[model samples]
Target: MDDMSENAKSEQYQEKTGRESNPIGVAAVILLLCICFLIDARVGFGALIGAAAGFFAWSLLKDNGTRKEENADDRVAFLDTTVLQHNFPLPQNMPIPYAVLDIRGHILMYNEKFAKEFPNMELILPVVEQLKKAGIGKHAVVVVEEKHYDAMLNQCEVVEENGAVGNVLNMTLVDISKQYELEERLDRNETVIGMLFLDNYEDVMDSLAEDRQPLLSAIVDRKLTQFAADANGVMRKLQMDRYILLLSKGDLETLKEKKFDIMNTIREINVGEHIPVTMSMGVGIGGGSLEDAMQSAKAALDLALGRGGDQVLIKEGEKYLFYGAKAGEVGRNGRIRARVKADALWELMGASSSIMVMGHRNGDLDSLGSSMGICAIARAMGKKCRIVMNEVSTGIKCISEQMAQDEYYQTAFMKEKDALKEMDDKTLVIVVDTHRTSMVEGPSVLEAAKKIVVFDHHRKSAQDFIEQAVLLYHEPYASSTSELITEMIQHIGKRIKLRSIEADALLAGITVDTKNFAVKTGAITFESAGFLRRNGADSIRVRMLFQNDIDSYKAKATAVRDAELYLGSMALSVCPANRENSTLTAAQAADDLMNVTGVKASFVCCKVDDVVYVSARSFGDVNVQRIMEKLGGGGHFTVSGAQLKDCSAEEAKERVRSAIDEYLKEETT
Candidate 1:
């Protein structure tokens, strides 16, 4: 046993680089085993016992090394309060709110500046406990109009007193007075200035007895005056039905916070006798100057009324925020002086030796008819005039046939290549009907022509051609481009013998666009139709122009059968494939479907190749123009169109449905 112990110790010393000797316990065991071995030959077991004792000693050394590594922190006390007190001291007088607390959520000290600034709550230990219990210690909790404060004491640091460990919390409190003040000022200054106008005010007044009419005027004025007072704003009765308001900017935020209660306020206006009342409001704000803001506000109001009444439109920069759009349309009255002025300028167009009248791609009746009228005027001025159109849709194929019968107009449909051949610096291109740059017949023609003129009646859209043209006449409230051009003809030299073909073309445009004077027909619409009748535009020929092939009629019927209604007022018809003019045919069929049971508005969609086209219609009971405009399209109050790229018929239908739902929700809630 003694020999075995000695050998084991020697090996252990070698493996450990001779660092230490074997333990005394293993040596004593080895000595006892050696005595036992000396007594008996079987005592050779002493070597085994000594080896086992040596192994146990080695295991104890390994465990001791591991324990030292794991419990190293016990040797160096981490909590040192004296070092912290000297390094981190609470500020004596900090502007921002600040606090100091000891561990256990006890407030040790607080800056008076915090209390002076936010005196809502007395900062004490009790308050700290209350705040901790509330579980909003780290949140920005404040009573808006009332005074309140939330203190967060989350700052934690280790501290030691006489070698005893503890924690000290140092936190900074913010008065937040200036922040609340600025927010209050911002809220107070956020004004939503809007203008309200009575629809067809003159017509309504004229319909009343002379004595009662003045009473209605006074009644409207007094109600508006009271309403403005309620909003803490100044009201101006600019016209019989038009009222201008100067509202408080702060009230605007409050109104928005109340979810825009102006809608409900309008519904509550009591007209003298029992009468249904509705108004179109335009709102604008956030302009650097008040005057510019008011101008924007007025423009928005005009658009709202122009689109039909009983709606609120808020204009911000170039985009619009629309609301409360569910209202029936009343008749629109607009001035034609602008169109007259545009036509008078045409005579002065003699500055250029020649003129070209162009329409948008796939020229419709209104575009073609309006361009023909302008062409006649240019020729009368002794300047060579040409009509530039790339394609005529199948719906207007008959009208194109009639235009070809006239030699004067036959030379008008000049292709882009042919038109470029005749193009020069002295040429003026007159764009008719459509105003969007994307919808123009040929963008290259516009780029080539330095001098341009535009005449359109569709509502303004994102891409307007007005800025590019030398002269622009855009009347959104007008019935059609033909109607606008007819008014312009009155100013041009003695209304020239309206050629039978020219008259028919103009009448066809009015018929196709107005659905034979059924939609959006106003006093001027009737007046223009009467003049065309005198100029040899036979109604029989106009009706014949609308007749379509049997297959097209069948397609129209199919679209009608597939029509889907939305908002209890709109219908959608989708045609995925058709070689004919499916969009136009579907639009007509949708209009016819409106007479069925409960439909008030209609939309038709058709897909050609990869592009999808949508046509919107209203029975004067709803305004589909705003809905279509949201989908990147524009037209009159009752009719509009849009094109969607890379979309299936079903996807387009779903989008239109979402728009309808959003629009109705805006009007109702």
Candidate 2:
């Protein structure tokens, strides 16, 4: 039994070391030794002894070799076990889904849970590359099977008998769908604040009889209450013309979907006549706190009111979403604000060492005339002033050329590049006719000046507003920027007299923008024109400033001839390509097309240099500013223009048609 046990242990050791003894060879050698012993007793005995010694030595060397081989095999087995344990520490049947993928995102190994969760799943190569670039050992959110998960990826170096075979990522996924849903729910339920103001409420009330005023007010209040109720919000009347509203994000969404129909509903209510009453709504959303939201609402309300009212503006962080700008601005009968703005302007100008007056690019009659008016004001105040003039169009070329020869006007006008050099820290830059920095003739001068003032009659745009203005006089209700400047001149008092030609220039601006006072002539507009006339502004000279050369007249005729009606009301005309002073020609063409009966609006497209210029005009019914704004331009409701870079005239005409179509579609919807 002892010998059998020893033989079993010896066999087991040999098998483990891969060095099993050769039993047949050993038996043959012993038999041969026995035969030698029988043949010669003495000689055989000696030979047997020699053979036994050699066999013993061979066995010892073989045992040493087997032991060395066994050590090497054990080391290899241990390394394999260590690597397996490091890469896959979890059991195959663990509940948590886990996968092992190579650096390239190829699946190498996966547990049963992972296989069940993502059957035949393959890792996205881009995602894996991103993970590898992120250097692994980090957690990232991933989605699988329409479920959110938090995946923790760990980088691993796989080892084998040779060396490091390759690198792999071990990904463990934790389901986070419930958490994600909860966050979304919280976000949707966040509170939002809003303010609604009845635009020109006092003016409308004053226009109506006392008995009718109460009826208009009551109707407006009731409609507002209904609007708030529809959105499941709370509304409180803040004043005779304003209300405060509180709602949730979801409620705001509902209100947006309805397009805030209260604006149109209020307009429909007639207090004995077409009162043209409208409301401006300002909403604040995604604010961090109630106070923040309230502040945002107030800012939005100011913006809406500044932009001619009759619109809905939603403030979300740094961005804004606008709706309902269908109606033209209600002309204001009061000049109280104009006087106030003039006083503010006087103080700002007084504080400056010098004043730089600038207008929009390609200075037109309105831009140039408005700049001249402001410069006149600065000269009256006994302050050094410079008018930054870059490009002059033919519409204002006669006046500009005449002014250039005059000593006083020569000193007044300066090139944009010189204007920048002349500006200093105490210089006040008054941007006239345009409030946008991008449209200013000398943007560098605007940037260099420490004090800034803006006087514009165009509607305010959220994207292109003067951020650094000390005083901004924007009256969209006024006919023209020149009209606003004229009002300021009158308010500045009679001592600040405008020269005969200066008055003519200001009148020319008003004439161009108002289409010779045939459109958008409000009470204030007439008052400003009257003031200019009293100061010796000649109507004939202003009319001559609007006359075009023979080529320009022919270009205008061509544009008018090519006019095609769109949506049955909008006339779209594409001028002949590459004409001199095409912008001026296109604008004249658009004005001429509007003369055609039944045309609500006219858009003329022309090409100059590499830009496509579009001039838009409307007749009280269509809001051309809103349409032009969509194409990165802005102006008054009845008159607006846009410049398209790197676009052909034909392409611009098509875009104009699309814009008109979109406007019509939205109006109907």
Query: Which candidate number would show the highest lDDT if scored against the true structure?
Result: 2
Best by TM-score: 2
RMSD of each: 8.6, 8.8
Clashes of 2: 0
Which digits, one per residue and each the tens of the lDDT, describe model 1 over residues 281-366? 78788677777788889878866754555667778778777666554455455545655665556655778867878888778888
Report backbone clashes per prediction.
8, 0
Per-candidate local distance difference test: 0.71, 0.82
Spell out the clash pairs found in candidate 1: 1-46, 81-160, 97-173, 188-250, 189-249, 190-249, 191-249, 569-601
